[model samples]
Target: MFRDTSHLVVEELSRTLERIDPAQVQAFVDALLAADKVFVVGVGRVLLALQAMTKRFAHLGIAITYVGAITEPAITPKDLLVVGSGSGSSLFPLAIARKAKAIGAKVVHIGSNPQSDMKDVADFMVRIPVRTKLYLDDEIDSRQPMTSLFEQSLLIFGDIVAKMIIDERQLDLKGLWQHHANLE
Candidate 1:
């Protein structure tokens, strides 16, 4: 049962990711590379995914932080705020996105529902188009429970963008090791 379930989950992830527009991913990468700093916000599992992305971006020498961290710096016009919420209406992320926009910072929303309130706040969106709690018509159906597929896809998408950044900058792979947490 474990093996069968694993295969099914992988298959679902593949389908969900395949539907995402490559152009959207490229735009997100461009924004990340252009930003002086990147701030991420989300809740629950989505926040965990963004945190992973934050660490990976740090490894690439990009200035990144998860919102609400004790050391989080003030966002400026040149910085970017990345909000991850499968439904795009998670209260905390939505509020943070709005605040970031008010501060003149660019906001990029990564979620399944493009039509959610986040649409008005985000400067742009890199949609995952997976099954969210809202069950929007265009979202890809998932057999997994709740928003698992979306969270899993978001995690993988972050890694994909990190790899794209590495390739675009032609960074030395060996040098990235220096950025990994030494205490861990």
Candidate 2:
């Protein structure tokens, strides 16, 4: 039963991944590369994923900070904020995205809902078509529980974006190691 469930999860994820548009992802990558400073924000499990991406960005030598970090600087017009919300209606992320836009900072929203109110606040968006609490009407029932698919997809997408930048910048493992924390 465990083997069958694992296979089902993979199958569901494969189908969800197929719906993602590479062009949209490329636009996000281009924005990340162009930004002087990058800020990331999310909530709960989504925040965990963005936090991991923030660490990877640091290792990749891109200036990045998780929103609300003590050392984070004020965002400016030249900065980019990446916000992930599976529902896209989460108040915290939406509020930050709104503030970023008002501050003249570019915002990239990574979520599953195209029609989410957060879409209006974002300057750019990468839609990941997966099941979330708000999107449970999906024809294919997900093996993973509520919003797990979307959260998983967000993590994978973040990794792919980081890899693209690492490759384009010709950053090798040795270079990444240079940025890794010595104490960790």
- For candidate 1, write residues 42-158 as lDDT tens digits: 999999999999999999999999999999999999999999998999999999999999999999999999899999999999999998888889888988999999999999999
For each candidate, give its TM-score against the true structure: 0.98, 0.93
Candidate number with greatest TM-score? 1
Cα-lDDT of candidate 2: 0.87
* lDDT of each candidate versus the true structure: 0.95, 0.87
Q: Against the true structure, whose lDDT is highest?
A: 1
Model 2 clashing-pair count: 0
Candidate 2 deviation (Cα RMSD)? 1.6
lDDT of 2 at 12: 81
Candidate 2: the clashing residue pairs are none
For 117-153, candidate 2 gives per-residue lDDT tens digits of 9878898789887877774564334768888887787
